[model samples]
Target: VYKGLDIVTAKVTKEEQAQAVHHMIDINDPLKEYTVVDFRNKALSIMDSMIKSKKTPIIVGGTNYYIESLIWQTLVDNPKRAGGDDEDSGLDESLIKVRRIDGSSNEELHKKLMQVDPDMALRVHPNNRRKVIRSLEIFEQHGVTHSEILRQQRLAAGCSLGGPLRYDNSIIFWLTCEKEVLDKRIDARVDSMMDKGLVQELLDFHELYNKDRLKKNEEADYTKGIFQSIGFKEFHNYLILSKEERDDEKGEKLLQQSIEELKRATRKYARRQHKWVRNRLVRRADRQVPPLYSLDSTDVGQWESEVYGKAVDIVSAYLDGRAPSQPALNSVITDTRIADNSTETSQYCEVCQRIFIGAQWNEHLQGAKHMKAVRRRRRQEEANEYREAVEIEGKDERAASVEAEA
Candidate 1:
């Protein structure tokens, strides 16, 4: 989304973009954050204009939340309280400003949220400071829990989790590749970026944006804007080195390490995308989801038949108001009873010294790490018991011996 993050994002080349119109690309400053709300509003306007001109707006993106914002009525709008009351109407701006200035941690914000809206707290991870603050803001603004607002929306939409689809006649095309194949492709993609002078690109960007910060001994922040890009942060150590140092053995090693880190991060990101598809889109039975068609793209040689051709045919049939020849992937049956209870209420695991929410707690109980921890604790307890028994027995024997001696 940032302008200067061209190489790392693998953004479409100017020549390719010239071939077809694209929206929401190169629209934000690398220094400033571009939010999902901003993207949704702009994309919706673009889609409206396209639809008015009798054109289909094809939404393509890896960011699932951005796509969700376009497809579902998910964004909550904060309205003013009745009677134009200013006092106690919304989150206190002064307090929030103070917190910002003080640099309040995510845990602090989450604790505050837990006090007011435990349900929302449960849904949002404590480490996700942005969401915790947002939920608090919603509650203070509307005089209702953020979770309650969503619950009402879902109730109105007659869905278990989210509101109804913004566009009823929507179709989803999910291109999938085998995990092993996808990992290889991700590694290859990183190598290709390297060949295209990715290092030089990072060097230029750092010189322009990050040199001053490093000189001032400020740590490179990878949580914000373009800095969050996988390749950018992985090269932080190498990027900070003096030109001569960067040319030395240490620099070469650091560069290699960064490259490998980039590859690993990219692969991990791919796995997360797959997990999101499976959990949020495929297996999710709590909401009204659009018909999804899966296309196997494991073999590039068969791309014409398996992916591109199938996608073209599916869209064509949908445009013609005819059922596609291929069967739509089935959604798991909606179990509303279970869905209602799946609010991810916070559950802490003492054995692991970590918190697991809702389904995660159940999964944690079944996980090997948790089991290992449990066994370790059990053995420790047994050892303590045996030691205590032996100590008591020794004390008794010593007393008996003393009496005999006496």
Candidate 2:
């Protein structure tokens, strides 16, 4: 499970291949969908085979989601099946046909989810259209919010929120470095990628898949497939530039911008990877997830002692059924538990046009927007009551003024 782009596995030397058998590396066509579930199933099969053959299997990768799917049951298997639609298994009608959330703007999708599952909406980044859409789909398909379903799943599994760990005995190693050092390393990696002809690779990829799709007036979504790779989209505009444009001043500026964009994206991705490891995997206190050993990679001078040496020792101790001296990092725990998922009792605010769930409802009550709306409505009610009183009592100017003042 080398969780990386094809370019990464392509760079592997012949000697490396001879050293050990590798699985799930460069196995999927770049144009096709190799989903996390597919990877998890295949990786599990490979691991099982390796175990039976008495060979140790090592799964390495930066794609935390794929690793997460492998280590924990985080995905919803099938909403239809869970909702008792087993009878429609003939032509794959079991799949819920909720309108593609991508059809709407990302903001719209996020806002919609906020209405149904505000807590989930808050947890999921607004820019993450995929997660937002999935949450919305769960709500639309099952008549239950995503948070409610997650709560049910957590309760069933006896885990807080990340779901139950598939392997409680598994040991995870997190290689960490200082932010500035990591950023510089990421910039260097981007430069290396460019030196390796990332531009040419993107051009070839675009010609094969994106060009034809665009010519036929089809969508070339960069959010899916290998296009989601950082370099691919960062260089999208540069790749589209004509050869004539490449020799011009504007082209040079665009090229520089794209290079900087690539570096920034790489650094951002590194931060996201660390955040996932710290927040999702390490913070869960409900059940035994996995023992994560943090290796400080800040100083490359200590690589042998800090990373490789520590990893070898930790693995050896685990194999020997002894506790390793390597201690786990302090838990970076946050409130992952869904405090409330009572969608049935949820109130829909007309002003905000948002659904308020338990604690969120209370918070909404105190929110500035809600308070302002309340004041506005109260003023309107007061005006209406005064008008009614004036009409019924036939009050003169003095009485009306007194009532209004009061």
Candidate 3:
């Protein structure tokens, strides 16, 4: 969401953007952090204006959290008014500051969250510093735990954690691709970016913004703005090289390594996007979701007929209040073993030294790594027990020998 990071982001060129209007493109300063909440608010305002003009505002993006904020009543605007109790219902004049606590590590922030809202802490991993901090901010700003706010919302709406849908007349279209095809497409895209002077773009950006910070021995903050973009951090080593060094053989190898890393990261990110669609939109049995139509985009050759054509027909049918010929995709069957209240809470495995949230715990228990850890621990315990037994036997014999000698 910043200027000058266009190549890595694969931002549409001015020519491409001119073909159609786009919102929220390069609207924020690169130095400043632009959050999901910020995106949601601005996008919502644009959507409202479009609705007034009788325009169908089609929300298109890969960022699920930002899309979730727009679709569901997830964010707690004001806790006082949210619960509708006799408690302070007045607007909080103070801003809801969702930032890290100064001088506190991620674990420390998570501990503070555990103290205030154990339920939320259970849901969020400590390593996810941003989310842990956000949960803490909720409690600090509203004088109510983040979990409590979600509970109140659930009670009020008689629905799931994020409450009901913001718009009743809404539909979701999930465009899916085959895994092998997607991997190839991602690699090709990365190659295209490199051909489009991605290295030079990073070099210019680093020279402009990051050179001074590096010279001062300050760590690169990848948590903010355009720095968080996949290509930037992946190319850090190559970007830091001097012009003469960058021309050397070692620098060429490093540059290739960076490109490979970028490709891998992009592929990994694509997998996460697919997982989000499956977990959040498709198989979430606990919450009410809009009808989702899956469009197979695996074969780019048939994009018009399989994807675009199907999407247009589905949208038209929905707008006309008629059922489309193509039926909505069914939710994937949830695992009965993991589909329990217990799974909603966090489960920590001492053997693995890892915390698993919700269904993750069940999955982890069944995983090879966890089982291996358990077996290793069991063997260690057995060895210790056998050693203790031998020592006891030796001690008894020594005592009897001493008695005889006396």
Candidate 4:
């Protein structure tokens, strides 16, 4: 109430969103599906606008990756620009310029990029189509590779504020407590959420937006990107429960148990998130990226307020060009359950790209049709290996001499 502003609104949606606004948070639709990439941009835009309007933007929410991605994507001359001209018209429009190509031809794309901007091609992950296609788009348009533009864009994009500050800092505050304390807190939180109609809200949203939303497994296969988010996944499970198992007394009990499990899972998850921020975000003292400074969240009087204050402080320090504090989220390595990969008799499927655990994946590989693919790839791999060996051993030269003598 610093400026005496009235209610803020967040979109609440099955057709809306999981958010609520004092002003109103449920404006975005559940079916529409939100993303970190968009959230980062939106947060930055809002912050910038608030500053210009002389308003102190008090951004309080359970947000993290958006903030991180905004900082990183901004720091790098991401989506490097390349020289492109219409194959028909050599004139380069620069910004709108693009050379579209097939997504399936990764090797061709790689070759094209190496010929165009070898440096960028090397740095981008081979399988990262987002980065690869972006790099290719630059070459297809400008005709000059982004590795070519980096030194120049640095001069042109100039001392821009927000997103990229020549340098930036990040701090991770872990609201840590003993396992028992955390479990108690989680138990309480879950009870509160239930009281607040978190379950009801789930039911409402499902009835409203499921036409647009999808199951996690299906979305995960496509990498729709929200499969890993906590709230999104919970919302998805609610839908799954409705679909797979009908609503009944037994179902209600199972759902209630699932809710408890989810609350516990989220608490465990928060700890893991803390671990990731601590580990993945750490930096060497002299590295170009800033280091992380972290502390226990429970140590503060209030967890939310303390975390928010430190995040703002971290952002403020970045804006002022001071060295950022190095606080990191520690590692919580989930996914520890690796299926038994050591079953010596089992085979790997190059086609499905999945390892058979205890003959499950092996069954798919050994199936008559799939085995045909395995046989083909194995033969090709062997031939490729043999050809490489022959080239290394000067067998190509020897073979040429034998042919000439014949």
Candidate 5:
């Protein structure tokens, strides 16, 4: 974001690398593929060099993989290895690289993984070819499964630059929207993209690499990201199939279609994302991960300050070693139909079937039940704060009185 963009280090080119002080973003080109192992390795190297000058690492990203990897490696592993590794450190690097066995096919991949850890092969999916390959590689090089390797890496040595994560080490802020609203947003975003030269870019790139202009199946990789995205694919199909059609008519038809499908697909995607966050991170106690702090994207509106303030609170709580409070993202945005919402009027959330935002839309969200939910959340936060205050301020009269009453 310094440049008002989310261009990651891996996507930049070498020539662009020389223009600014960049790291981690374009270390490899399209000629060379990238893997999570390489990411872990390169990220650590960049972090190490930064710390030598006593600079702070303020990692900010939406990529769960990058964020989780850095947090896991730094917090759980690498306690004693910070000063540099032993002579045998070369073995660790070799084990992390994605290597292949000779004449490797699906069978060989499974067989090799089974040899080291049959349990792992059973747990991992057969079609997860990348993971299966890495499991075998780790086994061959280190005589251990990847999971166990990480286990030992954690145990080997490391001192905490920070304390245990139980102290507000993180605030997993999940931005969300109701299915209908999210879909409309996606459709609108696609319409905006077309206006911003996406069509022209696609046309230019297509002409530059012409093979078959009429081929619908011959989608370029550049368009793959946009096309696979929620609203763009159908619009792209429309563009390709009707190149000679009027742009205004084509856009209107495609946008309407996108509005429908995006809602269905985005709802599913959001559900999956929520499930993953709950299961993989929030539920993993031993992982030192933090609890999620959810915000309805509509509620946040465009209140960047309020959103950022809540985020800062969550982060500071984690850094200060306390659970986060459920701060509101902001006042929610509502449809004009919800203007006269009231208790007897009956409000409903179509996605979750929860009676909500009250009889009047406003009352539904601030109802006794909703308020109770908020109160319960704040109670937990207060308890955590009280405990931490006693620890830090040392036997405050207020804390002592509360403890005595308890």
Candidate 6:
């Protein structure tokens, strides 16, 4: 929305495009569902072409998971595509009647997954139905449990989890900023987006894509596509307000509220990015994981010394085939990895809608809440079966009476 001023803009100036090539930017319509799987496939294709041409592909973005999937083979396919792309995970795309956990309650879905793959169910949170369903779908399509597949991948990678690295020679640079400075920048950025007509941009997007869905009171899923951007859902209520209401004091209050909410969401998303870098990127059970050099951007005044100059020296050394030196000021996280013993078979409690790992599963099974939920589920099953039986009996009686009359 901020045009050239924005960091993730695809509309690069003619001069910049002349200097360097860019890939995987503005490749999809905002309304359509462009999943991460799609993104990884497309990006890999671009990276391969660039590599074949002897060009170094510089992947720049804040989407840590996307970058992770690109650098590491995290996006594993089902058995059919074990050594292939996920374009054909052996799933039928034509079937509309495919059983999905999307509309089902968390408890019901968890129970279903438990019936098929109890161990997998334990690892997945009940609230995260999308992951649960995807795991179940993989099991159904490939006839192998998701956990088993992950176990195989981990064994191959020499780690407790995660797959092999796509590019071993890759060096990653992580830009770090102090929490106070970062938060303030994010707040200021949100305000700048507002000045750049963020609200109007959201309104335009909603009208173009979401109007039909909203008119029918259908679910506006912010989980998929470009609508997952920070500002879209934050201004949902403000967008839905009528013209009359929007012109009043209530609209002004809601707009201010939405601006604050957008700032808060941006901050939370920034924290999540940092967490992914720390936990997934840096901390790995396998020592072969890629080394990430940290670059401190806490002080903008020292950008030339801390960020740009240091980056230049590291890249130059890397190109010269010398071991890249770590910056003294811009330090790496040296916290040793702690072993998690929870990998032992986990169980899901239907009552608490929670998964208990290791010994906790046994304790949870004997808990009062779980026992009560079990009893309730049994009662519900019995009632449903009885109702079905009654309907069958009524049909039989009607058939007998018709036969007698004939």
Give the runs in model 6 whose Cα sits over 4 Å from its true position.
Answer: 1-19, 78-101, 212-218, 327-333, 340-406
Q: Flag regions of model 2 displaced more than 4 Å.
A: 1-5, 8-15, 79-91, 94-128, 132-148, 214-216, 330-406
Q: Write the per-residue lDDT of candidate 1 for residues 116-171, one digit (tens) a residue.
A: 89888887778776677778777766678888988888787776557788899888
Using all chains and alpha carbons, the TM-scores for the candidates as numbered come to 0.85, 0.70, 0.84, 0.46, 0.49, 0.76
Cα RMSDs of all predictions? 4.7, 8.2, 5.1, 14.0, 22.4, 11.3
Which digits, one per residue and each the tens of the lDDT, describe model 3 over residues 1-406?
5776788888878998898778878777676556676677778888899899998888887678878889988887644433322222233533224432533787888888888888888888888877887777677777888888888877765556567889998889988999999999999999999899999988987887776676777667767657777898899899889999999998999999999999999999999998877767676666668888899999989999999999999888887889998887644444431132422877788999988887788899999998999999999999999999999999999999999999
Better of 4 and 5 by lDDT: 5
Residue-level lDDT tens digits of model 4 in 1-406: 1111111111133333234323214333333334443455455666666668976544333455444554444423223311211123433444234433543566677666677777776655455555666677656655667665553443443311112332243333444466666777777766766666665665554454444434422222223332343444544544556543637675666676667666767787768765544433442121223444343465446755566676667667867888446433222223332232221232345675643434355567558878787778889999999999978779778888999999
User: Which has the better lDDT: candidate 1, or candidate 2?
Assistant: 1
**Candidate 2 to truth, TM:** 0.70
**Winning candidate number (TM-score):** 1
What does the lDDT read for residue 166 in candidate 1?
Answer: 88
- For model 2, give the 10-residue run with minimal summed lDDT: 85-94
Clash tally, candidates in order: 0, 0, 0, 45, 20, 0
TM-score of 4: 0.46
**Which 10 successive residues of model 5 have the least lDDT summed?**
1-10
Model 5 scores what on Cα lDDT? Answer: 0.51
Task: Report how far residue 18 has shifted in candidate 4, in Å.
Answer: 19
In order, the Cα lDDT scores of the candidates are 0.79, 0.71, 0.79, 0.50, 0.51, 0.72
Cα error of candidate 1 at position 97, Å: 4.0
Off by over 4 Å in 3: 78-100, 211-219, 240-250, 330-343, 386-406
Ranking by lDDT: 1, 3, 6, 2, 5, 4
